[model samples]
Target: MTDRRGVVAKRAEDLVSGVPYVRGWNRARRSAGALADQLVLLGLDSDFPGLLADVNVFGDGLVHLGTIGPEAAELLANLIAAGLEAEQHDTATEASSAMRREAPAA
Candidate 1:
């Protein structure tokens, strides 16, 4: 019974160790699919024939980024922060424009 338990535990541990890789693979696959969809939607598929392939490379890079080191993680964080800030700025600008349009002419 003890030997059987040990084998099961080892198998569980191995599966747990693979979780990160599985998650990364799923993320990369989704990212690639989204990129392909957007490319086709924008009609840029002909213009940038290799864009999807390039994006896949980037997706792989992102998947491995976390494993590289703290520096890579920090870089990714900074990118996310910058993107959020830009999105906020755009939203604010749009709101301001809408308000101005709605305001009664002086």
Candidate 2:
């Protein structure tokens, strides 16, 4: 299997480059919001002030993740992983719903 961190890093890179102009900015904002929510949920908001600041400043636009320090980049990678896992879980749940069966004779 592929390394999860590498996968998340690749995903982040794709999110940063997959689109252009307004659409890309919007996509970055949505991802930033999800990451920020995850940070707060994990109570790590204070641990990565720089990341939070960058998120707040560039959330409505695009962010240059390539220039962030190593610590911030690591935190971002973790957040991206969590987000991806959650998305997968949600997708699985939705797909599983189609396979649900009703109670038999009761």
Tens digit of per-residue lDDT, candidate 1, span 1-106: 3243232122222233324544444665677667557546855334334332111211221211112345544654675799899999999999999999999999
Model 2 has an lDDT value of 0.54
- The CA root-mean-square deviation of candidate 1, after full C-alpha superposition on the true structure, stands at 12.6
Runs with alpha carbons beyond 4 Å of true place in candidate 1: 1-28, 32-66
What's the residue-level lDDT of 65 in candidate 1? 17
Report the Cα lDDT for candidate 1. Answer: 0.48
Local lDDT at 39 for model 2: 69
Model 2 — which ten-residue stretch has the worst lDDT? 52-61
User: Model 2: per-residue lDDT, tens digit, 1-106?
Assistant: 3343222222222234333445545766677678667768977666555442122221234443344557766876887899899999999997787557543545
How much is the lDDT of residue 68 in candidate 1? 35
**Candidate 1 residue pairs in backbone clash:** none
TM-score per prediction, in order, is 0.44, 0.39
